[model samples]
Target: MASESDGQGRLPTGIPWSSPTVRVVLLSTVLAPLGVPLISPALPTIRDVLALTDAQASLLVDRVGRRRVLIPSLFAFSLLGAAVALGPPYWVVLAVRVVQGTAAAALFITTVTLIGDTFEGVRRNTVLGVNVAVLSAGAAVYPLVGGALAAVSWNAPFAVYLVGLPVAVLAYRVLPEPAGERERRSVSYLRNVVSALPAREAAALYGSAFLIELLLFGAALTAVPFLLDGTYDLPAVLIGAVVTLTEVASVVTSALNGGFSRRVSNHGIIAAGFGIVGGGLVAAWWAPTLGVLVAATAALGAGWGTVLPSLDAGVSEGVETRFRAGALSFRNSTTFLGRALGPWLFTTLVVGRGYRPLLLVAGGCALAFVPVVLLLGRRG
Candidate 1:
């Protein structure tokens, strides 16, 4: 067997970018976010081309259970089965979205499990934080790349999967499997995992996310581009790049999260994150410059990064070994549900009122969490 060293001969934990585990985490992060923003800008066109009503088209893309299956993979061998309905025929394409959404969730949650299991001390949080930051960055940059591809044809973002697929394969080959550490129990895997988590609070997290992301993610991708183009007469390429500017903030904040997680308690970090994100949203309400707008996005990106890892690490604390993967998957599935719902919610709002209310709603949704920090299960 290969030792966890590269040809350069560095220790496993010391070298992150070159390490097998980091490589895997990085690829999954890239793939997960890439699929969302990259294809999102193209959706209206796809709906129009396929002659799909907005409702039918949205349903095709937001397959909720499929996202659950992707992240958790509790079934072990059902990925292929899920991938089938995801093939085509507008509805099939929407169905396939479940596979993509779930697969993306799988990569993220599994990366967390692997990171939490494979490394310890400051390095673990550092690794997970950086992974999320990169996930956001990939999500940021992919729009420009995907949009350029869309200039030629609508399905361009899907093609980018080729880049990540090979790396995901390479990562699977090199990284050590996360050793399941919890005791095996007689209860069903899902049940045992659910017990490890605080469902009522988690449900709140879910509901809140559905509300916020439904607006933020949706508005950012669906409305922002046209808002800029139609209002300011900006070029598509520039608009694409602007969308990614928030990720740039996330990248900075992600590194910050690693340091912060180690120094502060999980609750502290989460509260601070919500605080900053909510603050950014309020500032966005008054945003008069592109610079101010990006600042707000950065705040949201950073806050989102902090919440996810802490939640994963926090929720998984008491999980049995057999259910670790399942529990992680469960959380990931809920996240996808938010993601799938986000764009359409914003779109519907745009159709009804306009961007002014959308911004206010998204920002307020984020701010509402300011008081929520004390409420989140008090895990320590």
Candidate 2:
């Protein structure tokens, strides 16, 4: 096998911004998160215009049932993107959104897999960090764009899905199939790959990924909105600003991830991420004012920024090339699963006990992982 640092060196051809490889991979990162928050600002308008129940409207960007099905998921995502723009009947829109969730799943898994397949070693780490940063940037932008478009027409936000078509085109042109794609898909081959991995270490990484996302989507994104609305009585604009601040922190941290990885062990970085997130969540739970809330969220964002790339790099390093895609896809699935479960699980746990306790639970969940990660690092 060709080494990542062989004569070709680590950098792919072309300038970073102008390169097709970077552009396609970065653009692909946008699609999944774009589906997540793009419709959020328009939900009220959609409910009013389409006469939808809250349950029906919430389905628009719900992450349920979107894992594992790769190629078909992208096709479904593009089609649903177009379909949702038509403002069809409520049932049709609901169905389209559910399927769109699956497509988002496909985009997420394929993009990560492509990154692992295309790059190696430090370059791989750098690209993964860039991908995570871009994802955070996209998450930050979606609500703002959705709000602006919603001001024009509720249907306008759905048009953002059209961005998928061009991204799909770019992906097809730039992404090469993995070298041993055929064997990677076989049931027995996959079993062998799974058997080859360091089970405890791999589990630690995947578990950390799931827990970090749960803190992100469940506690930070989902719970913070309610806290702002119910406790702070903040306006929509202020809430949006807070969310954007978190994403900004994440973007900055992710951009620094490559350098951070060079200085710290992956396990140390992962532990720090959990520590930061746990502390932030605890702060948010106790925060008496909006300023504190913003600071806490920034901490959470920073932790997430650190966690994602480190986890991706660790997992990629652990698996061989032939099984890399499957490993990545499984990791992606855990992320999506965390997103899907975060709100529901947190909400369920928060009932009766209230949000403060829920925040504690979320924060504690992250902190608990710190030792597990540390142990793994020592073993590795």
Candidate 3:
């Protein structure tokens, strides 16, 4: 076999994201986060139509646990949703959401896995920052689209998933499946799975922070329209606009944070992100006015922008080259699990005590992780 390294140890195509790679990989990244945001603004209608409880109705992430259970899990659940929606039953739709969460987990994890595998040096860090940015960009924009579509109908959000199959095809044609070290590491499938663990744990935590931030942010975004319309009596359009404002803040923070992260240490930046996120939740929980709520949204977005990039960078840096994709997939699963659990946990609790208590609970959860994070850093 001809070595990809000219015996001097270098790649033939330069590296991942060299030119057009970013666009192709990004298509999947953009597709994955788009679903929840667009649906978040329309959630109340779905809740009423489906007769679902608060906990049953929010956004999240999770693992595949069945089938090939990797990349396929990303889009399979969406197809499942489209199938179930034909019957138009609420329970089936909710079940589809659970499946789709698994799919989202696979997609999110797989992208990072591929990216970590495909690049090295400056290219690796740059790609990680950009990936987080793009993910946030999708999260920021989709809610407005969702809220606008809600004006037409509730099920309109599900249409976003229809776009995924094409993105997957794009991945096949354009995304480079770089096999430098991984190809040489193992010949067994079970060995490959076991090999991905240690790196996957770090990547998973990075993905976890991102998803947790999303969870907190998702809770706020998912609840804000309801909060404004129900609490402040704003119109859906106005709520959508406010949500857009929050997205703008988030996107801006992501861009700035990406630049800032390059200049600072990853650990410090991540710690700050957790602190800001925890604080933002508490602030928003107590906010007495619409303006305060908006400020809180911006703060939360800023925190995420900081937290996610550092986490992504850390995970990418830590993983072994060959297992990058597999490790990342596992990481993505953990992130989605946190995200999936977040909505369920928050909404379930909120049903009893309302939104303020929900924020307080989320804030507490964020704080609770700090010591755990510190402990991880201190370990061998």
Candidate 4:
């Protein structure tokens, strides 16, 4: 088998922002985070227009294969994104969002798989950190833009989904499936995935990914805007601006992830990240001023930045190479499952109580995991 570094003579030490392969992967990865937050600032208006209760409102905001599905996923993302703008019935719009989520999934899994395909060792970790930074970049920008558009029309923000179309074209032109990837396939699909996951390390990594996203979407993404809107009466644009600050912190932290990874164990970073997230949520629970709330969100973003790249790099590096595709797909599934479940869990718990108690509860949940991770690390 040809090594991953065989034909690609790229520099191993420096970040490769100029490389077309890296650029396309980063561009595609951004859409994963973009799909939700782009519509987040508009959620209040959307709920009002659709006559949705807060619980139902939580349902609306919400991936696929690797090489074989990348361009097609982009097209699906583009088309479904535009379809939601047609002012369809509430159920139809929800259905379209569901499909759009699948496309975003494909883009995510494929992009990460490509990184593993193209880079190795510490360089791969660096690229993964850069990938998370760019992903946070998308998360940061869309809210402001979506909020502005939502000010005009609830449907206006959906147009941003069309951005995927051009990215798809660029990917098709520049991103080829890595050599030998097709040739390296094992005939027994289920077995390959299972083999990759036999290690306790792989299982722990997936669990960390799941927990990170669950706290993120549940506490930070889903609940924050509602708190700002209902409590503070902030407009969609302002809500978006605040959300942008959270992601901005994430971008900065993610850019420095490679450095942190060098100094800390992945297990240590994951534990500390969750601890920071828990502290942020506790701070949010106590926030008396918007400034305090902003600081809390920045803490949440920092925890996310510190943890996610380590998780991605761990999955890539820890798994055996031949079964990597399976491991990555499983990691992506856990992430999406966490994303889906977080809102539901929050909405269910917040039904009669409120967002603050929910924040406290979520914080408690995150903090409770710290020792469990430490225990696992000791055993491992």
Candidate 5:
């Protein structure tokens, strides 16, 4: 039997860059966020062509299973995502998107679950880190690609969703159903999953996942654009460049995640990441110069890089094998809920108050949450 350290190296153990499973999973991870970001630059055109309300136009951007689950979900994700380019009526496009959102959810959940099922120990942490890094890279690139495509046609970006088809086909050919998956579905599956987790620990993990996204979006990503525009008087291009720094820093940090996890407890990394995010947000609240804000946001991204992968790996590691998917699915739900709610929270809280106060509140909340993470981590 191989020790967990069997393939340890400076980079990470068993990266398997050329492995079909690795390629397919990483590529699928890359596609996960394309649903919204890739079409973002074209939103105005889409709205104009369809004569949609600003609220209605914003619906396009938003936040998925296994083999039998994987193939159909991927195909649905591809078709529905691509169908938006057909110049359908507003309602029709929205309907397709709603269904596509389901497929997208399946894709997201399944990818994480697949990793939990496939890898173990530090290797799993590293792979999850790489998956996140790939996601950050894709996120960084997609907006630029979408902008370029939007220049050609408002619909061109939608075609990028079709990339899912090839990946689906590749998955069918190469991805294996993990051993014992057939045994996973039992009459007691739900009960077992629920009972597998200690109540407080689960709360801490899920709550932290939700809180991080809430603050990341509400205080940082959502408000930073307006802040840069109004306060700094920066050009849209410059603001975008500044925003990209977060993902750039995220990519660098996440690529090193396995190494960090090997040294720190997942909970410790998560707690520290949260603190770092708080510090970044506090810095953003106080930033007097463009350079300072840029650096602050980059620090925030570094915290993001560390926390997300660790949260994912932590959830996966804590649950019993039989209950892993269930646990991860719950975590995914919280994560998406947080992402969806963050902007809303920001809007609601910061409407008359201003972005600075929201950043302070959100940062303070994140820092306050740190002790909770430490407590849960210690108990677990």
Candidate 6:
């Protein structure tokens, strides 16, 4: 019968930094982005080994689903990671990926909920920004790791998923169960959480989260590889380095987000992020050289970097503690949904029109969010 504040107050503050809560939460963040970017560098190789079409390989990144079965999903993720590394047949790998996607969704939502449960005010915002930064750092590093491993074998990247084992163990020890006034079944709890959410505010925040990924995961991560591989014929290691640059920009922006929050309104930052992302995508679409692609991705990274922390801090601040896990699960699910839809949607568009037109469409989509975010800020 401990209050949420009791848990927050118990968090450790210094020296050796022995707080399992902090350790586990941060560790969880690292695992969340690993599902996509870790193997992205080796995707071409995976496609070849499995005799997959580009579309089939892309599905491996886009298959995330479900939130209610999070605990079991983590264990499933670990087992599947082993299965994938064992070099299962193409159909088996695809099935494992589908489950892994759900596990990624669970890890992301749970980590965000843990932060909301354990912190408040400026501390919460700081930790949220740090959480994003950690995810960006993971996105930045994992590709390089995957690329190096891919040099040895496509299966090596799958082995990296084994990182989930230690993360799961830490989470088991450190993450406290949600303590609401009454226990509710998952569906009932989710319905209640949705009903209690501030409709306008939630819409704007969640909408922004969805759109950000539609551009980040949907356009950039999904499209750029095809662009690089098809146009330049770059290898996985170099592709990873270019992708890492985008993440590096995100890392810097996320690290500085707390300071930016003090200077700009939440909506102002979000609007700017969308605008910049649009411009970056436009630049990326038109770029005639690799240097230009790098510059465009840097801009794209900065824009998305701005959007994520703002949305996270705003939603975490606005939601009630008991509803936080469900609310955040919903938000994380949007991101996964966006990731899943991005390749499929854009790839189809690319076939009919081409990459340039697709880029324009994606950029327009990002820019379209600015006014929606602005209006939301005004309402606040």
For model 5, give the 10-residue run with minimal summed lDDT. Answer: 1-10
CA lDDT scores, all candidates in order: 0.60, 0.77, 0.62, 0.80, 0.82, 0.75
**What TM-score does each of the candidates earn?**
0.72, 0.89, 0.69, 0.82, 0.93, 0.82
Better of 2 and 3 by lDDT: 2
lDDT string, candidate 2, 1-380, tens digits? 21434366554322256556567777778777878678888998998998888877877777661112334455578768777777678888777777777767677776776666666665666777889899989989888888899999988888777767766665566555556665536788668667655878777888888888888988878888888889889898888888788898989888777777667877788899999999999999888888888899889999999888888888778887677777877788788788778888878888778788788777887888888889877763
Clash count for candidate 1 is 6
Candidate 2: misplaced stretches above 4 Å?
A: 1-19, 65-76
Clashing pairs in 5: 64-105, 64-106, 64-107, 64-108, 64-109, 64-110, 65-110
User: Which regions of candidate 5 fall more than 4 Å away from where they truly are?
Assistant: 1-12, 62-65, 183-188
Per-residue lDDT of candidate 4, residues 1-380 (tens digit)? 11335358643545778778788888888887767778877888899998988767767774223556788988888989888888998899888888888877778888888887777665776888899899989877777788899999988898888888898899888877765465345568657777765466765688888988888888887798889989899997677677777788888877876677667767777788889999999999999998998799889988988888878777777666556777788898888789878877887889899999989988898899887666666643
lDDT tens readout by residue for model 3, 152-174: 77777666677777655655565
The predicted structure with the larger lDDT, 3 or 5, is 5
Lowest summed lDDT over 10 consecutive residues: which window, candidate 2? 65-74
What is the Å distance of residue 228 in model 6 from its true position?
Answer: 5.2
User: Among these predicted structures, which one has the highest lDDT?
Assistant: 5
Better of 1 and 4 by lDDT: 4
Ranking by lDDT: 5, 4, 2, 6, 3, 1
Prediction 3 TM-score vs. true: 0.69
Model 6 misplaced stretches (Cα beyond 4 Å) = 1-18, 43-59, 65-74, 87-91, 186-188, 222-240, 285-290, 350-354, 357-361
